[model samples]
Target: MTFLLLVLAIASEVTATVSLKLSEGFTKLVPSIIVVAGYGGAFFFLSQTLKRGMSIGVAYGVWSAIGVAAVATIGALFLDESLTAVQMGGIVLVIVGVLALELGAAH
Candidate 1:
């Protein structure tokens, strides 16, 4: 249940981020609304996850790490954005760091 909530938070954050790009400085109406709603949903779900006994450090680390990776991949694939080798490495490192946090929490 907590993991599902975290996934919802991550998805909301990623959607908000992608909508931010599509919003074009809020010039577009639909995406702008999505930006607000997505962020709100993200926070709400994230809070639910924390309330379910997940540590702040682990929850935030996983949420942000996965968000970054997903947004970057979506941008590169659909928005004509570039994802360089270095950035890819950084994403990998972020995921690894989040994994370390999760693992460390298990002990």
Candidate 2:
């Protein structure tokens, strides 16, 4: 299903972004490879989902927004990155935007 593929694309993109940090500036071979492959698969599947009827603008907006949020969370949890209150509020806004986009696409 297109929805499932879209979800996979978002997940793969998030995984790839997290792996990018683990890649250590691409010095670590394995993590670097994971980043490359994960992003490749994500885009490939996203293309398929688009072909399956989802609007490109809506799909890309949701994907990028969710990917950014997930990667930020991963950085906070695993990399011990500090998220200021303002940054946290920004992430919440991104989520709200994604939800609004999805709702608009439903009509």
Give the distance in Å from residue 76's predicted Cα in candidate 2 to where it truly belongs: 0.7
lDDT of 1 by residue, 9-101 (tens): 999999999999999999999999999999999999999999999999999999999999999999999999999999999999999999999
Which numbered prediction scores highest in TM-score against the true structure? Answer: 1
Candidate 1 stretches greater than 4 Å from native: none
Q: Which pairs clash (backbone N, Cα, C closer than 3 Å) in model 2?
A: none
Q: Estimate each model's TM-score.
A: 0.98, 0.91
| Candidate 2 lDDT by residue in tens digits, 17-97 | 888999999999999999999999899989999999999878898898888878887888889998889998998898788
List the global CA lDDT of all models.
0.97, 0.89
Candidate 2 Cα lDDT to native: 0.89
At residue 90, give the lDDT of candidate 2.
Answer: 92
Predicted structure with the largest lDDT when compared to the true one: 1
